[model samples]
Target: MSRLERTMNRYRSLRCSGIADELQELVAHAEANAVSYLDFAEQLAEREQQVRERKRLAGNRKRAQLPPGKQLEDFDYRHQTTITKRQVHALLDFGFIDNRQNLVFIGPPGVGKTHLAVGIADKALDAGYKVLFRNALELVEELELAEMKGELKKKIAQLTRFDLLVIDELGYLPMSRQARYTLFQLVHAFYEYRSLILTTNKDFTDWGEFFHHDNVAVPIIDRVIHHSSIYMLGGESYRLREKTTAG
Candidate 1:
């Protein structure tokens, strides 16, 4: 084999495939520019690093499961006047995640609660923080199933691995006893360790009714609100508005 082919094979074997793939282009550029040996090596390292960073971010985004097309720019502050552009933009700094705080959005359906939560989550993913998004009912059901399988603790551990957890559509439906208990366990696991972004339809007073028991709901609410920023998104439903306009 040629020396260049042998060198490319070596790079691939060392898991420097990014450098290996660009080897020909990089060599041509180096010869054209009469670049020093040190400069060429630095260029190769930079290319590899960039490629790896892109791959890592892509993987994190996939694992986050953020809803497609929900970004900060897509959020309509015009319809939902309760929250301002400045307030939402401030979250991009990611201090809340760094401080291990939570964000709670409370409002009726279709007021862009999920959109806001998802927008912030997408930003978090872009900022290199691990994030996971799930519907509240679905997450509770999953926890319940994990409990049934005697893997609740394991599941909780896996969940707590993310830097931020986005639980959408809380209080849209009532939770069963087992579901409430498991949900509490999962929330408790995340308390003070990682941040959470929650979108709920129910207010604080109505949480007891939503959970089916005041006793079980209180502790969960306490943990969720502690060190959290609560945003009340009030206005008519965006979906309803659109439907009416279409009609």
Candidate 2:
């Protein structure tokens, strides 16, 4: 009912949580330091902005679905010398998302395909891009179920909304006919609308074997490769190397 209580209540109602938290402490500091009115206002605004920025980054990270601890800096680039340092550095610029281009990483398992995909997508996430990451098999399974449930179109629409889509571990299993069809539809829809990243363990020549349906696989490859850069990686498994050293 008092003046100060009424003022604090108004700040809470306006959702100025950072200002509410720091008001009393900052006011004391301002008085002690003989701060001007403009300086005090700037401090209050800065505090609120910092709080909002932190929340934005956390939300972006969650939306990106990047596996934990897979940053480019943490990746052992020296081991995967096949990928040029300049090429790896260029990806973090996140320009491909703006240009609506795609990237493909083709290599054997344990050569850091997934790590590179996640790391590059992480940079986009930090820049406030909406990203979705899913294992290739998981995406195919979901699409298959959607088709069976007569929700294929709607599911593809939902996926196309993201700024970037990272599908990891392609060609690791034989895709079903329905899933292949669904995936083709997705690529066609995303063409020139959003960027995408695909990491596969098989060569382009062998991609048709995984789809098991030439008509479907070839189109997927054509659409994906039409506006994409492919990175080839070759090296011993970093995991195996680390284990050998630790032993």
Please report the candidate that would top lDDT against the real structure: 1
What's the lDDT for residue 213 in model 1? 70
- How displaced is residue 128 in candidate 2, in Å? 2.1
lDDT of 2 by residue, 1-247 (tens): 8765676678779998778777888788999999999999999899888888888889877777778888888887778998977898887777888889999999998899999999888888888888999998999889888988999999999998899999999899888777788889888999889999999999889988988856877778888998799998898988888889999
Instruction: Give stretches of model 1 more than 4 Å off.
Output: none
Clashing pairs in 2: none
Residue 208 displacement in candidate 1 (angstroms)? 0.2
How high is each candidate's TM-score? 0.98, 0.88
Instruction: After the best TM-score superposition of candidate 1, give how far the Cα of residue 161 lies from its true spot, in angstroms.
Output: 1.1
Provide the lDDT at 91 for model 1: 84
Q: List the residue pairs that clash in candidate 1.
A: none
Evaluate model 2: give its lDDT: 0.87
Instruction: State the lDDT at 205 in candidate 2.
Output: 92
